[model samples]
Target: MSRATVLACLVSSSVLALTVAAASPAQAAGVDYVALGDSYSSGVGAPGQSGLCLRSNYSYAAQWATRNSPATFQFLACSGAETDDVLDSQVPAMKSGADLVSITIGGNDAGFAPTVLTCLTSSDATCTAKVNEGKAYVANTLPGKLNATYTAIRNKAPGAKVVVLSYPNIFDTSAALCEMSMTKRKAINSGAQTLDDMIKARATAFGFTFADVRGNFTGHGVCAARPYLNGLTIIPPQNSYHPNANGYTLGYLPALTSAVS
Candidate 1:
C-alpha cells in the first residue's frame, strides 16, 4: 500500500507504535519518522504536492528527511488540516516503533486564514470582531482539543519523540499594502502570538519539544528586506500567506534541525 493510504486509512486505531520497537538500531539507517500537520508543515507555498497527502518534498519535514536520511520517512501533512483532523485521522501515522514525529497545527482551529481574508474583504471593525471570535476559540476551545490530540499521539506512539512546531509571525508591522489595513495586520499578528503561545504550552506540557520559528522569520515576514511569506497573489491563490521556499529552507529547516539534536 502507498504510504499515504497506510497513514490515513489502512492503519487501525488499535495499533500502537507498530514498527518502532523492532527497529534495528545497529544499522546505519535511523528510526522511522513521520510528519503530520497543516499547510505550514505541508509546504503549501512551496512547489506543488507530489502525493495525495498534500505534501511537498521541499517541505521542512522532507528536507529534514533528506538531511538526516532516516531509515524510513512519511510526509503525511495535509493542507487545511485542523487539530481535530489530526486527532481523528492523522494519528494512524503515529504507528508503533516510530522514532520521531513533528507537526504544525492549531492555526486552522483559530480560523487564522479566514480571519485574514475577512479583514481584506470587509471593514477593520468587522474583521476584528471575526478575529476576536477566532482568538477566543484558540484560548478556550483549542487547549482541550490540543491536549487530547497530543495525548493521543503520545499514547499511539509511545516510543517516538514528538516535536510540535510553531508558526511564524507572517506579517511585518512596517509594511504598507493596498490589500488590507495596518490594524488588521497587527491584529493578525496578535492572533499569531496567542496561537503560538498556546501551542507551545500544550506541547511542552505533553513532553514534546516545541520548535519556535518566530526568530527565523523576524525580519523576513510579509514585509521585510525580503519576505519569507507570500503576499496576496492572483496567480496561485492557494499558496497565499504561506511561507515560500526560502522560508522553509532557511527559516523552518534550521530551527527544526537545531531542536531535534
Candidate 2:
C-alpha cells in the first residue's frame, strides 16, 4: 500500500481499538451502588434523624455496601413508599453506570399500618377477613410494579446486579406485650409470607436476586426470640411497629450481605 494509505489504516485501527476498550464493562475495581425501597430500606424507626434524612447508619443496604468499602454508594430509599412510588419517585433517582442495585418495597402497598389497625380493632373473624383483603392487595398489585421497576433499572444501568429484598414478619401476637390475638398475628404473618413469595417469584423471572428475609426471620419475628420488631407502645421509642437498630444489625444486614456477595 502507499505510505499515506498505510498511515491512515494504522490510525483507524488504533482509534477503533481504543473505542472498543472504552466500551468494555468496567472491572469490579469498585462498584457504584444505588439503593431503592420503602421504610425498611430507608431505616425507619432506627436511631437517626427521620424525614428527608431517612437513611440510618444501621440500614442493611448501607451496612452491606460499607462493609465492602471503596464502593460508590447512593442510597435513595424513602419511608411510606408503595409500588407506584418506586416507579415514580425512586426509579428516577437511580443513575446510569450503577454496578449494583438493591431494593426493598411493597410493604406499604396494602397499607400495612391500616390493615394492622383493623386487625387490632376487630374480633378474630373480622380480623381474618381484613387480613385476606390485605393479602389480595399485595398479590394483585405489587408484582407488576416490581417488574416494571426492575425493568427500568435494567434499562438505565444494564450491567448492574439487582437484588430485591422481602419483608420480614412484623407481628407476634403470642407475646405478652402483643395486644393482638395470636390468630390475628398468624393471619398477618401468613400474608407477609405470601407477599414475600410474590416478590421472590417476580424477581427471579426478571433475573434479579431475591433476598428472603422473611424465611430468615421465622422464629425471630416480632413475637419470637427477643422480638426483632418493636410492638405498639413497646420499650423502644422510635416507632410502634418497626425493626429496631439491633434488628437491622442482626437480621437484615447479614441476609443482604449474603445476597450481594
Candidate 3:
C-alpha cells in the first residue's frame, strides 16, 4: 500500500480503538450505598431541597454516588446528628443489601459551631482547655459509639464495605483570617486533627476504612482560597467554617472511589 494510504488506515484504526474503549462497560458494577451522618453529609449549604428532615442533593455523599452511575444510593444522613443519633436513626434506615456505607459524625457531639464560637470569644487558656476537653470527650466516647454503630451496621448489612469519614479543618491558623487569634486557631486545628486521628485509628482497629478528608483539606480550612472554604462568612450571616461544595468534591470523591473500588 502507498505510505499515505497506510498512514490514513492507521489513523482510522486508532479512532476505532478509542471508540471501542469508550463504549466498554465500567470497571465495576453499581453499588447499593448507604450514607449516614450530619449536616455535612446532608449538604446544608449547596443549592438543593432544604427541608427539615430530608435535605437532598449537593451533599458530598449524594455527589459521590451520582458520579458512580448505575449505583443505587440511600442517604440517611441528617443535620445535627450526634453519635447516638447515628446509632438510633441511621442504623434503622439502612437496608440489608447495601454494598457500600459512608458516615460523617461526631460534630454535634462536640457542639461544633458553639464550641468554635466559645473558643473564638474566650481567652487563650480557656479556649485551649475547652478544646482539650472536647478532644478528650471524643477520644473517650467515639470508639464505643462507632463500635456499636458498626456492629449494628454489620448485623443489618453484612456485605457492605463501611467507610467512616473524618472531619476537615474548619479553623485556619494563618493570620490572614481575623476570626480567631493564630494561637486559638492553631489549637482548634490541632484538636480537629486529633479527632481525625482517633477516628482513623478506631476505624482501622475495627477493620473498617477511614476516609481522611481532614488531611485532604490542608491549607484549605475556613480561610482557604476560593472554592475550598467560603471565607469566614461561609454560613451566610455567620462566619464561614465548613467545607464548601468544591471542597467536598475535592476531598470526598477520591475517597469514595477508593472505598468502592
Using TM-score as the measure, which candidate wins? 1
Candidate 3 lDDT over 1-261, as tens digits, reads 443443332222110011111111254245677888877677654456366533556677777665565357788888767778888888888877787888887766765665665675578898888888888888888678767877887788888788888888776555475667777888888888877887788778868888877666676676555435544442232213555666666765556656656
Per residue, candidate 2 scores C-alpha lDDT tens digits across 1-261 of 443443332222110011111111233337787888877887865777355636776687766665566358888887667777778877777878798888887777765766666676679898888878977877887777777877887888889889888888877555665567788888888888888888889899989888877655556666665666766533222345667776677767766667765
Which of 1 and 3 is ahead in lDDT?
Answer: 1
- Candidate 3 achieves a global lDDT of 0.67
Instruction: Please list the Cα RMSD from the true structure of every candidate, rounded to 1 decimal place.
Output: 9.1, 18.4, 15.4
lDDT, residue 129, candidate 2: 89
Each candidate structure's TM-score, on Cα atoms with residue i matched to residue i, is: 0.86, 0.82, 0.82
Least lDDT summed over 10 consecutive residues: which range in candidate 3? 15-24
Least lDDT summed over 10 consecutive residues: which range in candidate 2? 14-23
Q: Count clashes in each candidate, considering only residues at least 3 apart in sequence or on different chains.
A: 11, 0, 4
Candidate 1 local lDDT, 1-261, one digit each (tens):
433332222111101111211223343176688888988999877786655555777788888787667888877788888888898878875566678899999988788766766776678899878878988998899999899889888888898989998999878888675356788877888889988999999999888999999998998888676888877644445567788888888778877777776
TM-score of 1: 0.86
Residue 29, model 2: Cα distance from true site in angstroms? 5.6
Full-model lDDT for every candidate = 0.77, 0.70, 0.67
Considering every candidate listed, which one attains the maximal lDDT?
1
